[model samples]
Target: MHLIELSIAKFEENLCRLKASETVCSSSFSSISQKLTRLQDLHECVENFLLLPLTQQALAQECGDKWINELLDGSLRLLDVCGIIKDALLQTKECTHELQSIMRRRRGGDMSFISEVRKYLTSRKDVKKAMNNALKVRESNCTDKNHETPAVVNMLKELDAVTIAVFESLLSFIAGSKSKSSSWAFVSKLVQPKRIACKGEEVANTNELEKVDAALQSLVSHKSKKSDNTIQVEDVQIWLQDLEANIQDIEEGLECLLRRLIKTRVSLLNIFSH
Candidate 1:
């Protein structure tokens, strides 16, 4: 995902440079074409990652003992790459607009090129929304109840670290820019605490397994009361199965979220290159 994002940014940079120039050269076209090819390959890789099975047996066999930590690390890298790609895409849109304005001032340049750029921009926006939603879902589901397993907690902590790194990078990137003071300052304030809070939650959850167990027991007991003693036994059994299934689902969801984030980053790279 990082590779894809970097390629995309390079592509966009080239695009902007080419647009700014009075003449379009063969080398410029070749660069854009190569970036486009790489973007497509990166998209395929993301799709393959998503299609991978998330079962413990599969993960163990494929990634061994370091699966969880490695997955988390990869996810974080992808998030950072995607974030940068998204920013690049936004900048690309502005560059395209400037190019359009320049073309409009020229004698015979076609204005329809602006419409094509708008179409790509719209697609990029949709991808960004999807990535944001995926992240939100992952954050929402990473709770004590759903992620009580030690492995999951550890993985989440690693993810949190990655998130913090990405957030800090973004803060630095924005701070270094000459944008409006209030806007960048506000973004910095908003992101810093969020990164801290996310990391804090992971730490809290790691040591709160006993509490999670207690809550699970309470939920089971409360639900068991809805039926007679004899029926409650059967219900309890069914409930336990359901609970396990829910846990598994949550685990799978986490994996899916990670994959989606990777894909999002790759897509962003594609947009940047375009």
Candidate 2:
């Protein structure tokens, strides 16, 4: 029991640190990727905590409780969200790769570039829609403030909430800005005389994903202009490569966390089955 308490305390401390970090540096590709890595570490700790003999005994005693059922349901939902994000990442990567290939080949001229750019934009919209649907799900709260829950149950509830919160952040990052403001509107800010005069450093700090988005919007809007003139094809390609690399890193982290989640779920099932 003492060891179990220590484990729970350590997990809570780490969770608090992650939440604090989120507030300070909410949404950059590097920050999101780092968050994913930290999440993977936290889930591994959870899996170890669940494997403790004391934890198994306690959970077994509470086998038929509502909280146990809630945990099981929450695990399934987490898995579902993981699957959706992984698929979205993969689709985006493939689309980006196709665009890069088209740019390199420059085979069919402006029409080909325009067709592929449109396809990539359409892909982004589809991914955003899927992420939004995933976000709409209201998770079951097993932690009741009015009713006193057991320590193990409370710890698990907090863990579930934190895990879901991290996933929500990741999903939102992938979905990009939801504001109706046009990508053109954003690009204009970059090139407008006032912005060009005053915003040198700030513009450089924008993420590769947004940079590519704005460049693509410019290309599509000015189809008659030479693509290189509208937005250097070379610059867009570099941004796409950077985006691809970051997405790949996130995907690897997600895969590891998904495995850890599965292990934790299986451990819970075994406890309840006994």
Best by lDDT: 2
What tens-digit string does per-residue lDDT give for candidate 1 at 1-274? 3543444344445434433431332222223223333333333444443333332333344443354454555556556544543454344344434434443453322345434434433443454454444344443223232343444233333333434333333232222222334323322332244443574443221212112222223332342233222122222233334333433433343344446566644533333233
- After superposition, the stretches of candidate 1 with alpha carbons farther than 4 Å from their true spots are 1-33, 42-46, 49-56, 61-65, 102-274
Best of the candidates, TM-score: 2
lDDT of 2: 0.78
- Tens-place lDDT per residue, model 2, 208-267, is 565577778777776325532244677678778988988898899899989988998898
CA RMSD, predictions in order: 26.7, 2.9
In angstroms, how far off is 7's CA in candidate 2? 0.7
Task: Give all candidates' CA lDDT scores.
Answer: 0.37, 0.78
Residues forming the 10-long window of minimal summed lDDT in candidate 2: 223-232
Clashes (backbone N, CA, C under 3 Å), per candidate, total: 1, 0
Question: TM-scores, in order shown?
Answer: 0.26, 0.89
